[model samples]
Target: MKAQMFDMTRMWGMVTGLVLAIAYFASLYLGFKASEMLPMLVTAIGGFEMFLFSQDVWIKRKRKHG
Candidate 1:
């Protein structure tokens, strides 16, 4: 299958979200809790975005083959 612009955009977004989530986790581990709720919010958004992008890829591949 050919690579599309939308796929690239999604991949970048997923990577960025993952990175942000990791950074937030590290900060929390180091006791950098400037705001308790913000870290949870960021983690939730990042995890959701990752899940959505992964589901999109799986569905596209399944559709193409089946």
Candidate 2:
């Protein structure tokens, strides 16, 4: 039997994506516009997730090559 590592970064990314999707649909359903700041907030969160994923990849590569 093999054990798999739990990836918090991936989990967070999925959660963020799900929340954004739900918010978008809910706003549409209720006939209300999303706030102007929503896009900026999403961008910031996505950027942070990308940074975390890149860092994880870099660390794994470093360990593999060293």
Candidate 3:
């Protein structure tokens, strides 16, 4: 998707990041449950989401008042 199309007010990317972060933590808290993949995936995805969300937010702010 085009970066400009993102909506900071909607915050979908941030929310998804939070959820994925929680899932990663939960997996770690549950003793990893014999697999090391889930938590890693969650963290990776969440980090990317958060990165994208922050970029989108900054873009919106700049466009609004720059």
List the candidates' TM-scores in order.
0.52, 0.63, 0.51
lDDT of 1 by residue, 1-66 (tens): 355876776677777767777777788789886466656766776777778779989999999999
Range of the 10 consecutive residues with the lowest summed lDDT in candidate 1: 33-42
TM-score rank order: 2, 1, 3
Task: Judge candidate 2 against the unseen true structure and give its global Cα lDDT, from 0 to 1.
Answer: 0.77
Worst 10 residues of 3 by lDDT: 1-10
Candidate 1 wrong stretches, greater than 4 Å: 1-3, 34-66
Report the CA-based lDDT of candidate 1 relative to the real structure.
0.75
Report the Cα RMSD per candidate.
4.0, 4.7, 4.9
- State which candidate has the highest TM-score: 2
lDDT tens digits, residue span 1-66, model 3: 554555652466667657766776787788765356656766776677778679879999999997
Error of 2 at 3 (Å): 18
**lDDT value for model 3:** 0.69
List, residue by residue over 7-63, the lDDT tens digit for candidate 2: 765676768866886787788789999987766766777777788779989999999
Cα error, candidate 3, residue 38 (Å): 1.1
Candidate 1's displacement at residue 14, Å, is 1.1
Q: Tell how far residue 17 is off in model 1, in angstroms.
A: 1.1
